[model samples]
Target: MNQHIQPPTSTASSRIYDILRKDLVGGRFAAGEKLAINALKEQYQVGLSPLREALNKLAAYGLLIQENQRGFRVPRLSRAELDDIAQMRLALEGMAFEQAIVHGDAAWEAELLAAEHRLKCADMTLDKDDEWERLHTQFHRTLVAPCGSVWLLRFIEQLHDQFDRYRRLGPKMPVIRQELDQQHHELVELAMQRDAQAARTLLDDHIRKSYDVALQCFLEHSG
Candidate 1:
């Protein structure tokens, strides 16, 4: 009699992938830290197959780096990588926002305002409140949802995940965060008014502010 072989289940793999991705984005693992397979199995209480599947998916998403001989490790932080992600976001999201403003209807405006409201009600602290993190992601996605470009949305999401890891793991500065909500309010007002150029400029400056904070944190920590 031949032995029976069971293939990896998609449900298990997908569940583990979501869980692991959340952990990675939440900065559960330190940069350049080696991920030991057996230890992870014990920690996540998952079988090997699903864990490996999740890890490979994460690596493909640029959250992890797969070594040639060794296994996977979190990507190391650098100024170059950080700046690249920031610049890409500014260009891509700026385009998306401008198009969204041009194409957005009353429904789009309603949803964007609602998302802003929800996000403002949350803690709004990077890495401090999980609810805030989720709402913030939703709010930004709503801003560009009317852009009507699948590729643009997809790329923006990937870049967001990459940049958010740095935001969550880096040092926090409360003093610099005071103006964020005001910026958000102004952005919503501009979008509602259909001022594409002004909105784009504001959005550009908004992203740069976060980039500056992330850069400062990176420098201080890496110094």
Candidate 2:
């Protein structure tokens, strides 16, 4: 018995786009795996048109790659591509953090402090803690919230999204939690002290460490 499926509206496409974006960024899809539209339609309970629209939007965001006649696949990860993204993050985030140090006021410091506190309080016992991810992202964003440039913030966010996909591709390690927490503590202290030079240096090292971890995991998995 054939079932009648209603045509998808614009809202359906937008909803599907958001869901698909989250899955891609969350590493739900394997790297370089082709997305079979029929399979997705069944899995997501979405029609063909909305699924295609969502996939096309993801392709435009560099989250998916479109082949000539092969439909879309998750973008493959590579050391070169990872390095490029890290370098860009270091450069741009460095600029924004410096400006934040120079211009951030008491309120900004307070917000950053609160965010860091919440991040520290996040439970790490669970393997996939949504609270931790949210608080961690909040702390980083709050650290540079006073950069005073909308475009800079937007670009930084886009770069972070790309980097996060790589990071999530790797298995989460519990051994690094203490070190990461310490780094975040120091970053907060440096920002509070308005030590731009030290803060920037620490931030660069922090970012590089994440890249190294992602690269290591990538090599191990690929090998």
Best by TM-score: 1
For model 2, give the 10-residue run with minimal summed lDDT. 1-10
Model 1, range 1-223, lDDT digits (tens) per residue? 4335545466778988998888888889887889999999999888988888888998999989999544999888889999999999999999999999999999999999999998777744544577778888898999999999999999999999988877776566665565666788899999999999999999999898888777875787588
Name the lDDT value of residue 6 in candidate 2.
Answer: 50
Put down candidate 2 lDDT per residue, 1-223, tens digits, no spaces: 4356554556789988988887887778888889999999998988887778888887887889999654998888787888898999999999999999999999998899898888877744536465686687788898888899999998887788788888876766656645666799899999999999999999998998778667776787679
Candidate 1 ranges with C-alpha deviation above 4 Å: 1-8, 124-127
lDDT of each: 0.86, 0.83
Q: Looking at model 1, report the run of 10 residues with the lowest lDDT sum.
A: 1-10
Error of 1 at 137 (Å): 0.7
Best by lDDT: 1
Go through the candidates in order and give the C-alpha RMSD of each one to the true structure. 3.5, 4.9
